[model samples]
Target chain A: MALEQGDELPELSVTPDKYLTVRYAGASGDYNPIHIDEEFAKAVGLPSRILHGLYGMALVARAATEAGGGPASLARLGVQFRGMGLPEQEITVSGTVADAGEAVTTVHLEARQGENAIIREGVAELRR
Target chain B: MALSTDAVGTSYPPVLYAVGREKVREYALAVGETDPLHLDHEAARAAGYADLVAPPMFTVVYSAPAIGPALFDPVVGIDFARMVHGGQAFSWGPLVVAGDEVTTTVTVKSIEEKKGLGFFVFESVSANQEGHTVCVGTWTNIVRGL
Candidate 1:
């Protein structure tokens, strides 16, 4: 697929199971109680155990890379955590080629849960 | 307690991580990555990789030990109970595959107050066994005020 400017990458959607956060915490070695212990999360002012911000970021990165080229083609991926991500809700990752340059291409991507943007300002740089 | 601005520029000891095939596969599966390059060695080799490729986000595991000090430093005083991930950025260099040894060095990039919250930034650089950079990551955290 030619990465022409304005070309849309195929959208990827994932619904993390209720225990996804726990699995992610273990897989990523980011055993923060706020991501696993519901009681601990509530005490800390969150509604409940929330997904690790990196989990959503990774999914978005994968979506961009899978479409742009592949893992090795990804030069950079950046994102800001704008909203809390709860498990059991469907999250969608979508993006468009923002700049198709001779040497590199940029993809403006985002991850959303319902109407909320969980990973905002998503940017991915792909090497041609 | 809030992280002190004085902690900015503090450098933590470098951490060495041995990239394992199973760990790489586990991380890819955990993130729901279905790419065979990250899951099958033969596919990775066919794709020009030496082994199963570690997805870009695997930097989280390889750099965590180096980043831990800044979040736990007493002088820095991060309020763990109220802290949350704010943002993340990564720039990749050489692709990381299984059997590689990665060493990550971390430094406190900044600490400041923004909108009554404490914002902390840490910069980490991971290098392959050959000393080629594998990834550069900027990690941000926000601590809500009392």
Candidate 2:
């Protein structure tokens, strides 16, 4: 794929299962109760046990890598958690090539759950 | 309790982590990454990586320990119960391959109290055994008042 500004990268969508949250907690060593305990999440005023923001960020990073060519191609990524991600909902990761230079390609990324944008102000730079 | 801005600029000693192929693969699986470069050693090598390539976000797995001291510091007065992950950012250097022993040094980048909320920022740098930087991560957390 020839890199160019405004080109949409391939979209990556994932539905995070309830069980996957537990697995991610164990794998990432981020055992925050809000991510694994539904009751705790409610007590904290959340709708439910929300997925870890990094989990969603990781998916976005993967999309960037896939778009840029490989894992080694990713050089920078940034995301701000705007909304909560509930388990079992489909989250879509998409991006557009913001800049295509000879040495790198910058991508403006976004992750959405249906109509709500869970991650905003997302950006990634990939080595060309 | 308000987080003390006085704790800003505190730095923690480096923590060592041994990067394993299985650990990387497990994280990739948990994140729903199906790329062969993250799971298969042969595929990784074919793709020009030394071994199974870790996802860029995989740095969080190894570097989380480095930020523990600041997050739990008694002086900081961070209420774990009220805290939530606010955001994350990353800058990568060389690719982290399996068998690389990395050390992460964490520092408290900033702390602020505003509008009945506390904001904390932590910066962590992970370097390989050869002293080459693997990644730099910035983690931000927001703590709400009870």
Question: What tens digits encode model 2's per-residue C-alpha lDDT throughout B1-146?
Answer: 64567878888899999999999999989997888988899999998888998888999988988889878987767887778788889999999999999999998898887788788899999999999999999989889983
Q: Using DockQ as the measure, which candidate wins?
A: 1
**Candidate 2 lDDT score relative to the true structure:** 0.89
Kindly state the number of residue pairs that clash in model 1. Answer: 0
DockQ of each: 0.86, 0.84
- Give me candidate 1's TM-score against the actual structure: 0.96
* Shift of residue A115 alpha carbon in model 1, Å: 1.0
Please give, for every candidate in the order listed, the TM-score of chain B alone compared with the true chain B.
0.95, 0.94
Off by over 4 Å in 2: B1-3, B114-116
